[model samples]
Target: MDALPFALLLCGVFLFAGAVKGLLGLGLPTVAMGLLGLAMPPVQAAALLLVPSLVTNVWQLLAGPRFGALLARLWPMMLGIVAGTLTGSGIIAGAAARNASVALGIALALYGLVGLLKPQLRVPPSVEPWAGPLVGAVTGLVTGATGVFVIPAVPYLGSLDLDRNDLVQALGLSFTVSTLALAVGLALHGALPLAASGASLLAVLPALLGMWFGGWLRLRVRPETFRRGFFVGLLLLGGDLARRGLA
Candidate 1:
């Protein structure tokens, strides 16, 4: 692709990804990675994800009122994510395109299927102590491998029985931590070059603009219906990724 065309495409991807996150409080990285993975290495896509994901997620996190309480409850999981990402980073940074594509495809597919199914999963108050770390660790490993951060993380958060705003805030907190951990991991592996970082910084403008637009839509549109459409898109995107990887 020509430089100009690629830049335009990258901005377009972020705008769409940002809109998704604004509407649903998640899916920014998932959408960005899925689309960008089609056109570049997953690691490169991930490097481009850092700034926008971190900035948006931090805004989402601070917009909530329950940060302290959520942090108290979710600290163990955050720590586990950091550790797991560091442990798994080298493997993913060195992985071939095919392996990364397969990993990304499977992760996106599973996330979409789970979102569509909307299982009535419940993580008992008692089970959370151990379950949180385990889930976070696995999620971190997956993020390290695929540059995507949904999976067990989103489902596990869904099971927590939080109110709507709290749930959204919790998702933000989790994603913020995941983005940071992934950045560190990529840096350690020398996968986050300066040029990609600069491009990622530039991508933030369209992302934020899209988020603003999506947030506006959220007040007027039915979120449940939009969520369904989003998941369906994910499923189709995931299947295509897997097919391309295997081919």
Candidate 2:
């Protein structure tokens, strides 16, 4: 495929994904991964989304309240992220393209529903200790393969009810550390090439802008309403991708 078209498509997609991330704090990878996986290989898709995901969420962490407290509480969740990334690498390197696309598209569609429907979805002060390893492992497997693994954990994480500031802070830290681990794993497997890396990096500007736009739009709507829009959009996008894969 022509790199230009893929790159162009990514910029447009990230505009929406970043906007969603800026408002809700975690839609970048979910949306971008689903769209990219249609053309890019899974590991390559992970690599492509990793950089922008980190860059765009920085706004949230920097401005968030109680950032340190949230970080302190997230050590276990971070552990899960690491484990999930490592576990996911094996799957990414091996997953068939069509299968990976369908799985990621479906996962993205589901998580978008959670974000659209849940008025209260953020991290809590306390969560199940075992939740980290089990959930993280599954997320990591999906992350390595599809970059959509984070969706499974989003509902639980989103329901934290930490207000907007601490919520984004927690997610920034979470995605940053975990996506970094995923990048390492992909690099080790030689999946992080110059083309994907360049595209991913180039994507950061639009991603950040989109996040800012979404954040602005967020102020205009209720959380559940935003999530509903996000969910419907994902269902449409996910359905399209699934059908294409089937075809």
Candidate 3:
């Protein structure tokens, strides 16, 4: 209720977030939550990102059979994310959370750029099995504290030589599971209330709409072009986070 006005502001944020995610296959929460966190409480901003995160990915996961393959391949990462979410959500709070948010904003920005530029930096598919849990834990801790993490994870995944789209599909699928579980865990702990939940849902519209556009745009972009553009956005985001932190 209190953040209603700001929540409405997130409508615009979600639009950009969606567009980027649609185009890049990730970065929704990093874009939306990073910007919003700068302007509001990190927890509230994260809570707001919750609904948008889920709805957008539901479609992404449905983009093709790749999502199915990703789920099984990256199972360990999923476990790490879940475990990290539980632990971080339980332990971190207040100013530390805020600090993490600021740090993460910079990380998100930089991470986005890195992943975008190196979309084809790949490893064997077998790597994903172990990667799943490792990145999951790392992302879980970062996201739990700051409510974002996949920025780093994406680049890590991109370092592998798999299909760029498929790499994205894998991250999106695992992230979808991890973030949703994060919201549920937070809500159950009474960290996110109905107002937060409802507002998060409303924020989803622009993001969802944006993703649709991104999907359309993805068809037109050369894989390398997409990677470069995505990384440029990442650099900007990193600078933004740094500014927020220093300010």
Candidate 4:
């Protein structure tokens, strides 16, 4: 693709992804990777996501009131995420890179299906200390492999019985740490190119703009219906990616 066209496509993708995040409180990186992986290689798509994901998630992380407490509690899990990302990134950037799309597709499909089903899983306080780092490690492995970071992390966090604001902030903190670790992994593996990084930085503007628009829409529109529809759409997109990968 030409430079101008690619940039335009990226802007559109991030804009839509950002809107989803603003409206639903998450999904920017997952949605972006699912779409971008259709054309770009998985490694490049992952690299492009690093900057915008980090910036937006950091903003989300700081916007909440319980940042210090959450950080203190989640530190072990966050460390595990960093460790797993660094460990798995080499495989993602190596000969196994071709399979990244398939992995991402599978991740998205599972996420959407789970969202649709809405299973209620509880994590009792007794188990949280051990579970946190284990879940974070698994999530980071998936993040490093496929550039999708939700999986077990989101569900695990949701099961913690946090209030709404704390839950959102916790998600943000997890994503920020995951994105930073992925960026470092990509850099270490030489998978990130200068041009792609630059484009990612520039794409942040459209993403923020779309978030503003989605936030406005959230105030005016009923989001439950929209969220369901979004997940359904993601399910289809993910299925298509998986099919293509298998083909």
**Cα RMSD of predicted structure 3:** 3.1
Residues 68-137, model 4: lDDT tens digits: 9999999999998998889878766877656877887888998999889888989998887889999989
Alpha carbon lDDT at 133, candidate 1: 97
Tens-digit per-residue lDDT, 58-117, candidate 1: 999999999999999999988878787777777568868688888898889988899999
Winner by TM-score between candidate 2 and candidate 1: 1
Clashing pairs in 2: 84-140, 88-141, 116-227, 116-228, 121-158, 121-159, 122-158, 122-159, 122-160, 123-160
In candidate 4, stretches whose alpha carbon ends up further than 4 angstroms from where it belongs are: none
lDDT string, candidate 3, 1-247, tens digits:
3557775677888998888887767778877776786677677777888888887776666766677666766677778877887777653344455465566666666676666545555556666677757777887877777677574566676665658678657766766876786786677557888988887877777887888888788888765676676667667766776676667
Which residue segments of model 1 deviate by more than 4 Å? none
> Against the true structure, candidate 4 has what lDDT?
0.89
lDDT string, candidate 2, 123-222, tens digits: 4445556665566666666676666756656555666565666666776776777678788878777777888788889889889889889879878888
Clashing pairs in 1: none
Candidate with the greatest lDDT versus the true structure: 1
What TM-score would you give candidate 3 relative to the actual structure?
A: 0.82
What clash count does candidate 4 reach?
A: 0
lDDT score, residue 76, model 1?
Answer: 90
TM-score of candidate 1 versus the correct structure, residues matched by position: 0.97
